[model samples]
Target: MQRYRMALALLGLAWAAGMAHAASEMPVPSALVGAWTLERVDNVYPDGRRVELYGPHPQGLWIIDAQGRYMMQMVRAQRSGFAAGDKSKGTPEEYRAASLDSNAHFGRISADDHTMHTHIEQASFPNWNGKDGNSAYTLKGDELSYVVAKPSSGASEGAHGEVVWRRLP
Candidate 1:
């Protein structure tokens, strides 16, 4: 009786492992699976004025795998460097600049037609860690663009954020 119970437990464990592996293989949209380079980031106000969120020239990369996993990072092209040459020794201004100039996150993502859903497991901003977000997007040829309903950048009261990317070759 003891041997039969042990065999049944081992069989159940093997079945559970197989199910877990299958869950990670969830398919992602083909159009969104690739390496993409950031083209620009902007903030558009309610009045029709648009401002560059990350300076005139920004830099970033976003990579999405076929299995719905992704990582993304974006930064201003002209961010100021720390005067101390050591990150831990930066002053208050330096720390604030560093935090405001970059954004990064990674986790599972999925898309359906016009909206992309993100499950951020971790992010540069602690508030976004373990958060889920949905953003509307447009995919035209090699370019993909999305608009954030509410921006993290503390812009003007009614400003919305936009980010554009170009698919890599």
Candidate 2:
């Protein structure tokens, strides 16, 4: 029994170590060469209604290093302060609020100048774990904008969301 417990513990440690290494190693795509700041994200419906996905002045940043690893984060504007001054001391409501207001993910990417494919290794949103997806993008000067090549479940036919980004120098 003691031997089995020791084996399990070592396996757990090995898995954690593997995850840490994978997080830092990735091949970055050339078209997404720089850091990009989120300008806005909007969901347009077939009925012509436009909805802001993260409130006005939504905050986000995406960075793709030369190695192909990337980290992306987004949050609603003006998130509430955790009253306790300690992140772990926040109330359940505070925790829920924070999760609902933001998202983050990290992974590897492959792209040409027009299309990007992501292999998500980790994500704050659990449902996206181990998922792979792609987007179509366009770059004009300092701006880089992209849209999901396929309609999301919330989108009606012929409707999609657009995420605009500004290239960082």
Best by lDDT: 1
- The lDDT, on a scale of 0 to 1, for candidate 2 is 0.80
**How displaced is residue 128 in candidate 2, in Å?**
0.5
Q: Model 2 clash pairs?
A: 27-68, 28-67, 28-68
Residues 1-169 of candidate 2: C-alpha lDDT, one tens digit per residue: 9999999999999999999666444345566777989999877777888777678899999998777778999889988989999999999999988887787899888675576778889988777889888788888888888886443334546668888999888
TM-score of 2: 0.72
Residue range with the least summed lDDT across 10 consecutive positions in model 1: 20-29
List, residue by residue over 49-168, the lDDT tens digit for candidate 1.
888877899999999998899999999999889999999999999999899899999999887767898889999988889987889999999999999887876455788899999999
> Looking at model 1, how many pairs of residues clash?
0
lDDT of all predictions, in order shown? 0.89, 0.80
List residue ranges in candidate 1 displaced over 4 A: 1-26
Best by TM-score: 1
TM values, all candidates: 0.81, 0.72
Candidate 1: C-alpha lDDT: 0.89
Residue 138, model 1: lDDT of 97
Residue 94's lDDT within candidate 2 is: 98
